[model samples]
Target: MGEVLVLTAAAGVPDAAAAGVAGRATRLAPGAIEVALDRPLPAGFAVPGVDANVVPAERRRKRLLIADMDSTIIGVECIDELADFAGVKAEVAAITERAMRGELDFEAALDARVALLAGLPESVLGECYAERVRLNPGARTLVRTMAALGAETALISGGFSYFTGRVAADAGFARNQANTLLVEGGRLTGRVARPILGRAAKLAALEAITAERGIGVADAIAVGDGANDLDMVRAAGIGVAYHAKPALAAEADARLEHSDLTALLALQGIAADAWVD
Candidate 1:
């Protein structure tokens, strides 16, 4: 009755037994294996191209999902894409990199980037969404499949609400939250609404939602790819760093580098056939 180590690959199931790990290996899906372990994972134990996670088997599946939208669920960072429309992509993207890496304060970075887009046309938001925004592979399946199983789903972001609202619908999240971009005279007002949704806000959303659902914080799974997502990710029962920056990856309970979002389901012992389209 020890913990289980979940090994998930992007293709075929990895052979944990063959890797010299001592355990009873169980295949959960085509590309997933669970190894029951009585002791800590041996030093340097790894399988090429496979992401591994060790957790109590009893807490494998979560009842709530709190996900960061930009660069985690979506392929592009919304602010960076919006900056492109404002002719400041290079400038803004640099700050974004630093912020995601935990080198810069998230709120300050957001303020500087939005300030650079002060005069951009409001219509440019639509242009960026149409031209640059896209759901990363397996995003919809991950959200919809979890929702199908009666779990609550929320998309929260440090990015603006405009993109989160649209992405949440496309990805089938039950609700969404993000900072509001202030607009005036058909152009950006060079400011976000007060009380910006930064790292602290993301953590608060996780707390509020879980409380509203009458579930413990440990009943949630939080996923993201930035430093802004660290708080809630660390607090959740399962915290995943999805193709993340090094800062987040270092602290995540599970890291998905080679596989897609469906791998999260695999970690939860859900097979591919049960996924919702």
Candidate 2:
């Protein structure tokens, strides 16, 4: 079907209007706006208070979505909770805070934190996954909406694959990718495998997923909440930082400080009431 796409110019970096095209213009970012309409837009039309340009909507791609797990899809930090299980919540949380804030080196800090959990029994991993992890509000609605729209979804995390795998299963993701926690004799070995998944790994996952799906980067949307997520979010057509760290929120293509994951549905022309949870 013919349609109109209102996009922002890379140079202009326009702001969103108080009300979107249909009613209120939702701000996707400093330079992006999401327009909702029942039909194709008239030529040269512009929504008042919103800088809109009309383009063929069919040209827009609709496949490949990459998302981060901890803090993005789920409300809690799986590793920190695992620390609590290991009786080192205070120490581990300190390092986690620094890493999330981009103050300490991520790879090194991750190693130190995991080392603290060295003697932790493998069973605590399941305890943390079961007792601590909860899906972020509206996460199911967001992922289901994307799948219904024909987008292939994947969950990538800097956290361990054990947890990411469970989250992916519960959240309807097509695949899951994450770091593996080294284990020996039913306890953490205090070390992670080489080529740890950090900023570059996250971005590379986006590229790999898109290529495997035969889709362009512009067709994908990536979401996350830490310094490590910056590269992936920036590379996708729509990169959202949901309740992210301050630095991440500042750089993301879209910021969701006040809303849940459901806010993303608006970007794809799905209204809140119409959203399927």
Candidate 3:
């Protein structure tokens, strides 16, 4: 398993950056190149618009994909948008930020935020989904491509099941798991169901989902953007932080700051032209 540098940039790998490569670039797409180097990446070697990952050509593609829903797959945090109906967007979004950054306890933060939504009509959830919730760039390509390649895909979230169920169906995820929001008489009870699905449950779901596919944790790739996703992100062999929170970006194996969710496909040696719609 020699070092392979995959750079995604317009000017491509500057001659200075590919100093130790033993092979020529096999262009995966515009601005993306794969070069096998005789030696490992040098210390502090980095280029702008270039994402360098040293992976074995054989183990690049993963058999399982576990992804976080909010701010990773979808563009907005569902809870924050739903809170707008209750006129508590600022209050709930603040908590959502802290929870994602790892500064606040996940379950407690979720409980406090949901408590603020008490008494809002449950129909607002639908409105928020239709108008506020949106798929991030490259979300479908990432999932559809992996699923097309025989990988098992799952959407796991600390968000409510209402959104996950819809997103899973719309995005073609094989399965999904999430916290259930309690509603009474078409209005939110402002309470989450018992045994809230938090950080631990996410990690557990990762393990369970992969096991069903007859693969171990090392064959899985997990992507997320928040603190609650930290555990599972680290648990997978390929943990990616997609436009992530500071804590998650610092801890995950790779950070996708510039590219969309489809960057995950590049990490797995999939070319842009090969991506599924």
Highest lDDT: which candidate? 1
Cα TM-score per model: 0.95, 0.80, 0.93
lDDT of candidate 3 over 1-277, digit per residue (tens): 6656766543444554555566666766664667766666668877766666665666878999899999999999999988888899999999999999999999899999999999999888889899998788778988999999999999999999999999998888989999999999999998999899989999999888777778888898999999899999999988988888889988888877666677788778789788898
- By TM-score, how accurate is candidate 2? 0.80
- lDDT, residue 40, candidate 1: 79
lDDT of each: 0.89, 0.75, 0.85
Indicate the worst ten consecutive residues by lDDT in candidate 1.
12-21
lDDT assessment of candidate 3: 0.85
RMSD to true structure for each model, in Å: 1.5, 7.2, 2.2
Worst 10 residues of 3 by lDDT: 8-17
Q: Tell me model 2's lDDT, rounded to 2 decimals.
A: 0.75
Q: lDDT by residue for model 2 over 1-277, one digit each (tens)?
A: 5543444423333544323344334455443556545555555555443334333345344477688999999988888898888889999998988888889888998899989889888988888888889898778877877887788988999999999899998888878898999999999898899889988899998998888888888888788998888889888877777778986877876666655666565445454455566
Colliding pairs, model 1: none
Each prediction's total of clashing residue pairs, residues at least 3 apart in sequence or on different chains, is 0, 4, 0
Q: Model 2 off-target regions past 4 Å?
A: 1-62, 272-274
Error of 2 at 275 (Å): 3.3
